[model samples]
Target: MAAGAPRIFVSHLSGIAVFDPAGDQVGRVRDLVVMLRVGQRPPRLLGLVVELATRRRIFLPMTRVTAIQSGQVITTGVLNVRRFEQRPTERLVFGELLDRRVTLTETGEEVSVLDLSVHQLPARREWEIDRVFVRKGRKGSAFRRAKGEALTVEWTAVTGFSLEEQGQGAESLLATFEQLRPADLANVLHHLSPKRRAEVAAALDDDRLADVLEELPEDDQIEILGKLKEERAADVLEAMDPDDAADLLGELPTDDQERLLRLMQPGDAADMRRLMSYEDRTAGGLMTTEPIVLRPDATVADALARVRNADLSPALAAQVYVCRPPDETPTGKYLGTVHFQRLLREPPPSLVSSILDSDLQPLDPEAELPAIAGFFATYDMVAAPVVDEAGSLLGAVTVDDVLDHMLPEDWRETEFHLDEEVATDGS
Candidate 1:
């Protein structure tokens, strides 16, 4: 970059006014776009994402950016009127990247990344990330942050956590995206080119990969799973919610299904085998083998701990199954379930059996989809237990799984538009 090129924190750039040459006001900065290249070098700044008064958004290339002054950005590129859709090679700094957390390699301390600064490349119109601002303290409300702890550091000093590291490939991307929720991560991944998506899928740990897989479309699920080595693929499937894993596995050809199943842990393989045996339209097919199950004598505190697992879905976490001896499902005798509402009302020292909803009958393993839907509707339950004729708890069907099966077959391919107001960096 030129020795004296203007350098400013990204926050200062955000919301700055943009004008075309001749000083005609155009729009305001919504975010900055950068293309992550290969290796340790800083990513090249591509352009700015601007939101016009009409609420439409568009990309303004860097070549057109003549100067960036306090409160204003000047551009010479003709603005395209089309709505902004992020391309695979591009990432939005303010929208999804600003103020995320990262580990400083030199100090081994984790800090919240506050902003980044860019400068023009010497003799070239291109811009690149030059500095990173950070803060150390507690996180508060989603939007508001703690103050008086901020500092600036050279970007290279921050290591092991960035999606923008040029040559590091998937590892860099995973580090860069540590803070993204599974759904948001899925959205980002869905927009990636096939090669980038495959790299990310292969790099993610089994649990993280499993979570992202659940949010993706079936075709995406198939494509990503197909990219993993057979052993790792089986591991990820085993980590997934049983119902979701079953659904994805069912979509694969018989040969691939059998091969992957063979690589799974025996118990997990057995559970999947049982779930696969049922038609997708039936209760057996829709239920998840993993649920918060507690022995009748287990305390409310114990039940609460199980539900507190961060990985559990909202619906699955809403209740706990209180079963007789043998807590493992499919063999555990079905007693009844205790809703989270009832648990909180009871004393923590109370036994789970004291709060059991004994009268809430479980669904039959063979119950059809309509019956499953009606059960959820009739009882006003977020989830319902499934049981064999022998009264053994088979699994539990969550509302999300039921809706997945009930929704239109092509629902996954449907496109969605972002709402008007945007939150910076998913904050």
Candidate 2:
């Protein structure tokens, strides 16, 4: 759903068929998962518990969902088959919330929940329960419909659903830090005891956990990964950036690495193996296999659309790689680069190949850390493409990855504090 989409009542979504991009039904939504926040803030609609044809229930993340229409939910077709497990922080809308009695904040009168309405935030993928459909006088039973006034109220107009501000446990801790960036959240997780860290990690969604794991130290990453079930660990690894996932796998024992790789999707496993084949500090190892790749004839409009992806890092989005036939990594003969600034200046319909910066030399797959860093410094580039001896576009290395390798091993452990006075003056 886009900005200003009409709010959908949870009752309407019940038992809705879930379809893939191909329009084939994959499953039906059994329930919605939400994480309650501290205080009366609306709970975030995390994802859905989808029941497949085999009677197997799995988690379908909202990130993978493309649209929720009248009777069906359309997904990006990337479904993780692992069984859904409710964490300490997750609440099931169907099983826990509906038909429950809660108080109205305005009149202090108790109301029975009939249904809840959720809306996707404008310009964002996140959805939240924003309204409540309730009965005023009495709770309705399965066999009896009590005579009572029925009405809808804003989510904030009710109480008793959200977590308490002074609540303890990982649920409260997670709620408190829900808005923190992955790096800042990783820092917080780093300071926690191993048990607390594991609890918090388990409470986080796979995509979120993957982002935080990429920012954490190697030891922490290994420890947290070890604590999760093998299936879940594999899912989280698949969610991580290819290079980062490969780097983490490289730290594990050979047998453990092989086990996780076997559990991942074939395409992801292949990318991991390819990345792992490279020397740790080389261009191939540092590069992400999923950089935006466009064919020679792609237009400026196409390039801009790819760059606008919310999942892409600013460094990776700084430019796009133009290649031949195959658009994926290990693409057909590398053409050249098209910087973001150049894309913006060109007419939307203009061919990207026409404005390609072919003069800038791309890095060789075996280029070492020092040489790769030198290329970035000399070219003043945030990212540089990597090509194999055959001239196939392998992947692209961003300046951030270069810095990650150049920094001391214990650099992540160092605590940096900003002085309030200095920050005030600077601002």
Among all candidates shown, the one with the greatest TM-score: 1
| Poorly placed runs, candidate 1 (over 4 Å) | 1-168, 410-427
Q: Identify the leading candidate in terms of lDDT.
A: 2
- Per-model CA lDDT versus the true structure: 0.78, 0.84
Each candidate: RMSD to true structure?
A: 10.1, 16.9
Q: Candidate 2 — which residues are off by over 4 angstroms?
A: 1-169, 416-427
Give residue 324's lDDT in candidate 2 (0 to 100). 97
Instruction: Tell me each candidate's TM-score.
Output: 0.67, 0.60
Cα deviation at 110, candidate 2, in Å, is 22
